[model samples]
Target: MDLDGLDALLAKLDRMDREIEGDVGTIVKNNTIEMTQKVVKNAEFTQGYQTGYTKRNIETKIVSNLVGKTISKSEHSGYLEFGTRFMDAQPFIFPGFYNQKKQFLDDLNRLVK
Candidate 1:
């Protein structure tokens, strides 16, 4: 091919390569944003589950302890104090609590993913 023609072809190829690179960069950026959003959403969900599980567990323990101690139902306002103390004294209760929480959270996570 003539030198002028060869040069023009090379220039066109360079422009095409630049366009392809730009497209690839856009795709990567979009994917990265999507991935980041998903991670944030998952983290929020996990935090919510942990908070709710802890609250319910505390309530249960307080009620159980108060009843066991023969505290009058009229005097106890839902056993909040007892629950807090019981949970503080026993850390292993968390695993069983989390296990029950996991069933619901796992289903939610599966749907989200």
Candidate 2:
């Protein structure tokens, strides 16, 4: 068996891995931000900006290098998302998640390629 330039190849792969990690994190954070915006928009569309509480409460946070979150902090957010016995479900967050998912996936696929 003969091996040459394996160390250099490994070093290159390590660097590429690091770069990909950073890029993936950036993509996740950006997508979370966009998802937040989409959720707010959907809230507005579904709820008609009654008090603007949900829209204002929707926010994006980077939980870690590769993890991100879109949070709806309003106390009534869940009520509105899942609805109650008295009301039918008017889903903003779920719709927004579905809407932004394709873009997020495309962004990740593009990054990998």
TM per candidate: 0.39, 0.91
lDDT of 2 by residue, 1-113 (tens): 98999999999999999999999988998989899988888999656368787788888889998888899888888878888898777889998899889999999999877
TM accuracy, model 1: 0.39
Off by over 4 Å in 1: 1-4, 47-113
lDDT of 1 by residue, 1-113 (tens): 54668888999999987776565444444433333333333323332235444222222211221121112132222332233554322222233334444543454354345
Candidate 2 residue-wise lDDT at 94:
91
- Error (Å) of candidate 2 at residue 20 is 0.9
Span of 10 residues, lowest total lDDT, candidate 2? 45-54
What's the lDDT for all of these models?
Answer: 0.38, 0.87
True-vs-predicted CA distance for residue 107, candidate 2, Å: 1.1
Error of 1 at 14 (Å): 0.3
